[model samples]
Target: MGLALQGEKIARNRFTGEKIENGSFMLCDFSGADLTGTEFIGCQFYDRDSRQGGNFSRAILKDASFKSCDLSMADFRHANALGIEIRECRAQGADFRGTSFMNMITSRTWFCSAYITKSNLSYANFAKVVLEKCELWENRWHGAQVLGASFSGSDLSGGEFSGFDWRAADVTQCDLSNAELGELDLRTTDLQGVKMDSHQAAQLLERLGIAIIG
Candidate 1:
């Protein structure tokens, strides 16, 4: 159950059921590795330069748990991350473009300035996550739980958030133009300085009992 690294280039490496507790992997290259069901408990990863990014591209990371990891500037593009649980992870500036996160649970994770475009995030839980200045356009968030999460200054114009519960979330200064806002709960959410479409603004005003004068 200990941490193990094999292969010269670390490509096509498999590590199932391995326990990597409290490990600090700085500037490690994990590109194209099959790390299915790996338990990364309390791991810290810091990529100072963009060139020293941790790559998890095309990796099968199903059911993998990353608890309390500092994964700043890590690249997880095109990774199969089904049912992945990433709790309390500091994932600032991480690239999750085209990553499949079906039924994933990501609670209390800080995704500041992260780019999550074209990702499949169906049935994902994002409770209490801070996504400040993040680019999450064209992402599918069907049936996702976003309770108490804040997305300040994020660009989510092309994201699908039709039935997502955004209560108590601070979405101030975020661009949500053309996003599906049908049945979205904005009761406890802050919509101050948020950019909305003309139709969307009318609908939101109607919901708030405000009469619009043409």
Candidate 2:
């Protein structure tokens, strides 16, 4: 048992570097809050009865992390999430449509950052988002909508991509070693500068009716 609160308004508050474990903040409003370096482990942000989740939209979440948290259907739209970490969290159906993980360098140049490893992101909506040059390994991406999105130069090794659409997004120069790349059409999807292990390469070749034998 941990701290439990429902329908709380914590907007624009600074909870930097704090750790909350096994807590519940169901249907809470955290918009415009500064959660830098804050860690939430084994927490619940979604209200199952009401089918609503905590709102973190427009929040400043730089370097903030969440591990083993129930973030299903959470609203993270337009959040500044640079260097944010979300490991092993249940974030199915979470809305990250306008989340920014990048630091703008110039008008036409920018670099992105975020660590979202080993999480369940099934049915999540990431349409038109940019996650370039980030660490996003070993996560489940089933049924994710990434239309017009770009994941270039990211480390996406060991991910489960059963229902994801490869052609819907830009995944160029990504590290895809040991990933469960379901129906990743080589001809249609651009794989420029992408990295993969020999086993994965063999699998891809097999899809094209080419067999490799020792």
Candidate 3:
């Protein structure tokens, strides 16, 4: 019931500190825009009929947040999403293939940052993305494609990782405590420095058919 603008070209515009609730921005081109500190709550960015979401490719989204937004199938490829927060949103099938959350210090060194907590990232594609040292806790990663992705040193605790391929990505040094690690084969995954709770350890043991006498 808020602002509705579909298929519009709003690229390179600055929308800082604006809050839009229950709005629809389907197929809008927001490329090269600066959306710093902007909040979108309960908004619709995907057009189900046309099967396309708003084009946010290459946007500067520093400190921007989305809560309870339907960003299904949205194109967020190659966006500068540092310090961005997404909480309790439906982000299924969203494409974040080349998003940058890193601040490079040299040619071969960088530290990444972002806060994507308690959101549903089911079926979202994060292939080859570098999200090291970020806060990605309590999110649903069901069937998400993370091939060649590196989530090292990230806080991925309490996540629902059903159908996730652990061997296809590098999750070393990640905090994966209290997460539903579905079908995670330990032999194929290198979980060095990865943290897990006792329950999760037991679950992994049980999955490997190891009987616990105690």
TM-score of each prediction: 0.48, 0.96, 0.94
Which residue pairs show collisions in model 2?
none
lDDT of candidate 2 over 112-210, digit per residue (tens): 889999999999999999999899999999999899999999999999999899999999999999999999988899999999999998999999999
Model 3: lDDT of residue 127: 98
| Predicted candidate 3 versus true structure: per-residue lDDT over 1-214, tens digit per residue | 6999988888565466788888889888888788988999999988999988778899888888999888888888999998888888888999999999888899998788899999999999999999998999999999999999999999999999999999999999999999999888888999999999988888888878997667
Backbone clash count, each prediction separately: 0, 0, 0
- Please identify model 1 stretches exceeding 4 Å from their true place: 1-111, 185-187, 209-213
TM-score computed on alpha carbons, candidate 3: 0.94
lDDT of model 3 at position 182 = 88
lDDT order, best first, reads 2, 3, 1
Q: What digit string (tens of lDDT, one per residue) describes model 1 on residues 59-97?
A: 777777777676656677777776565655655456666
Candidate 3 lDDT trough over 10 residues, lowest sum: 8-17
Model 1 clashes, total count: 0
Deviation of model 3 at 157, angstroms: 1.1
